[model samples]
Target chain A: MEQVYKRTKGIRDDMVSGFCPGCMHGTVFKLIGEVLEELDILEKTVTVQGVGCCGLAMEYVTYDCTTSPHGRACAVATGVKRTNPDRLVYTYQGDGDLASIGLAETMSAANRGENFTVIFVNNGIYGMTGGQMAPTTLIGMKATTAPAGRDPKVHGYPMHMCEILNQLTAPCYLERTSCNTPANVRKTKKAIKKAFQNQLDGKGFSMVEIVTSCPTNWGLDPMASLDFLEEKMLKEFPLGVIRDKSREEEAV
Target chain B: MARKFMKGCEAIAEAAVRSGCRFFAGYPITPQNEIPEYFARRLPEVGGVFVQGESEVASINMVYGAAQTGTRAMTSSSSCGISLKSEGISFCASARIPMVYCNVQRGGPGIGAIQPAQQDYFQATRASGNGGFRMLVFAPATVQEAVDMTYEAFDYAQRDRNPVLILADGVLGTIMEPVELPPMRPEEEVKALKEALSDWTLTGHRAEEKALILPGGWAGQEDRCRRNANMYETWGKDVQVEEYETEDAEVILTAYGICGRIARSAVRLLRKEGMKAGLIRPKTVSPYPYESFDRLNYGKVKAILSVEMSIPAQMVQDVELAVKDRCRIRTCLRSGGEIMSREDVLKAARELV
Candidate 1:
């Protein structure tokens, strides 16, 4: 019998990813690796890794990667791209890294129209730090910090990044997709590809927010975590392209 | 190059460009705003990148990123603004990223005042950030020295793979003085310099090779700390200080930055009066010219006086440690943005004697 499928060249075959079993980071990393392979830009691409569960994406991804202190990946990515304009640079950031401590950097980079890509993985809880309440942690969700279900009165409501970033005029693309189901996972991959393509075309700032899940941190099995992300997380963060300016000339 | 009367901030900006600094990121802060302003117009002309970051915190990280790419990068801010950048500076040091920054210091233990003061001497020399990491610090007294120090800082930073800071006061930042600018670094030279760092820069590498450059490099916490300690030990060899008229003197004066210049004037006045007064100024305050005191004629010197722009005196502690109580030490301090006057330094010297 012949093999039907082999690992993508964009990812290193010999290395084991540090992400936990059933964690969606592997799915997202695989998708990114496939995208890099499809685009054939892995040789010139660099990944700015954020500090969190997403930081370990470097272990699996073959492209050059540099780590930034917590929440500064976008800012670092801006520098990397600005200095090496010919290189394709992107930041792989988790919910806490992109939303809470790094909110200013994300908003400012997008507002300035920095020429880079931001792959924001919104998993609702701080997975690496053992499930602390993230800026995107849903209301009534239980976290290590919020022992008794999160209350909007104290914890505040969850932040919607795509909708917020879509309000900015400079972004060439802004989309919110998920990896919960086969269909949604395909859509998320397409969204990531479009973001990367926007950078290659010199279109300006592009961001793809992918709704992912943390099975271990969510206190659920892999299947239940996917279901939770589909039913609950999707309610807070909607899926689909929120902004696309690449077609503005055709639309006009 | 022909000498031009330039403002301290503007000269430092041009010197940074001449030093091959192609990436400049900064936020507007008092006494240092002109630096970013100059780079905003100049950097684009030289095919460089200049970003006016939303905050000091963002600006330093931007430099941190650019430095990781092996580009000569820099940022500037005043006293409290540097405090805002402490975390990123700490990260840069921990990661062994090379970059330069300037502190056009102003009065502050808090948001005290915007006028000139050397109150940040302790902050810049002793504890720039949380980690016990030390940077090569240069305290310049004039626009010419500031320009020279700022230009040389890039080389030192790249040589040591560490952050180098220019500690200048608001007076030095805002004042105009004649300065002979350094030659502009050629574009090809800049590219070649960056290319030389390809082995360590954060560029994409082959899949089989390990390309990760972690903070303090592939070592555990304690081991990294030990490596950092060893690096500092090597850097200790670069300790630099300037001694003026100390030979055959009975009383010696010590200061840094603008205070040192004032003490130099006081020493001149004391020397004309036939009194034996000399001056010792530390150029690199961290490696700090302790040996300058060690080489002093302790048999002739009666006492040491420190002049500074801070109340309760900060640099005096370092001076005391250097002198080791071989001679009496006294301090003349002017706080809350008060400039240390030469007359006050002269009077302090007289009292010490």
Candidate 2:
């Protein structure tokens, strides 16, 4: 039997093999493209990718893509969405890009309830510039920036973005999902689809924070990275729907 | 067809509306707050969008977003606010997004004062941010000119695919003058003009043809820089200035924007005192109206006094470069938000004469 899978309409043919072996970013990107393709809104979608390893996301996914300065993806997306309200706009940001430098832009955009979607990729460490200590880096995680492990006294604790972003009343959808196992990966895809669907329904400011694995940055092979995410990362950052306005009666 | 007495800020807002601008995003600042306030009240009546952005940075970014969709969009602020807006301005310039920005200038190296000053001349005409890009800078002298130029700014920005600046000062922003509103252009004509530029705009792509791709980052870095520089060079050809009795005058008063208005008043007073003083008011500061000064008798003109509201910071260098050893030059200015009065300028001219 043939494997039932196909690339999204805007996915570049040449960028097919650039992803590291078993990288969750590739899976998440493909899932986002699939969601857009399913909704038939890929043609009018503009994705603003944040600065980090995920910053280069525009190169792979082929819809009208724009890259903003580190942590400013949401602000740029706000501009795109407000100007072209007819078009669907979204931002894809990593932990460092969203939780650190871009926290202000993200928070403000969410608070304003800008009509856009944000796909937040929360890997434990900063994967782009040699595995630095990210705001989402869990306690005792051994990465390049925190070789002695993350210290709450010095660097603070791992940030729960889904939990934090959920507290705000503006966002229509806020969920935390994982990509460490096949079942969880399916659940992550469902959450990603739901976020995009919220934008389609004209619900404002949806975000799906996917707890993904960074094998290269985690100093592990593909399987070990998945194991790390399942055993440690998920334990530190729990997986659940933190906020879903679509489930509320008032949202309807 | 309606004639009304209006402040410079109000005129700018009215002109923008008359020109079919439907999107305005701005943060309130002294002198220029009137522009935003006017738009906030007026825009909704005409089915336009007016957003009071979180900050000047957010406002400009909002304009950038709106302009990308091929809508006529604008933002207005003062010196400190404009300083916050430079990054978005540079982005719009690089992206070739058409938008209007009104800088109601105030005194400042920082937040110097909220009163009138022309200290932002260099900032407006020169590189406002980190890039080799030039915005179409129009220095409006009177409240009437501020209104007219603001309407013209939208046309110029779309025609040249660049950002346009209406460089007014606090005096012009606050002062009142009679302004005859121009006849409104048909919306279809404005839409046609925007559609004509669709070859380069992000207005969705046709099937089987590649979309007009804009570089997002330093993806093709050097090539992008060269392309932006060439666009600046091509657009710089339309620099303009107004020459007043410059032919036989012995001294030239070189000023621009609101400074030019004050200098004109002072020039009249100097003429009454029997001195052959003339005024050279640059309308386009970025292109600097270099050719206008080239026609003057540089050797015969005793000196060129560069009068401004800043510490003679901007026009001084331009005057020095233009007259270069052909004549003596002096700078008279009143900074820190203080408007240099006609009496003060005449006093300075009398001493020099």
Best by TM-score: 1
Candidate 1, which segments miss by more than 4 Å at Cα? A1-4, A250-252, B216-219
lDDT of 2 by residue, A1-252 (tens): 997987666566675545567678887887887887788876777777777777656666666766565676777677678757777888889999899987878888898888899999999778878799999998888778778999888889898887888788898889899877779888988997888778878889898999888888888999888888888988988888888888894646
Off by over 4 Å in 2: A1-3, A142-149, A250-252, B197-200, B206-219
Candidate 1 scores a C-alpha RMSD against the true structure in Å of 1.5
Span of ten consecutive residues with least summed lDDT in model 2 chain A? A10-19
DockQ of each candidate's interface versus the true one?
A: 0.67, 0.44
Fraction of native contacts (fnat) of each candidate: 0.57, 0.25
Docking class of 1: medium
Model 2 alpha-carbon miss at residue B223, Å: 2.0
**Interface root mean square deviation per prediction:** 1.4, 2.7
Among the numbered candidates, top DockQ falls to 1
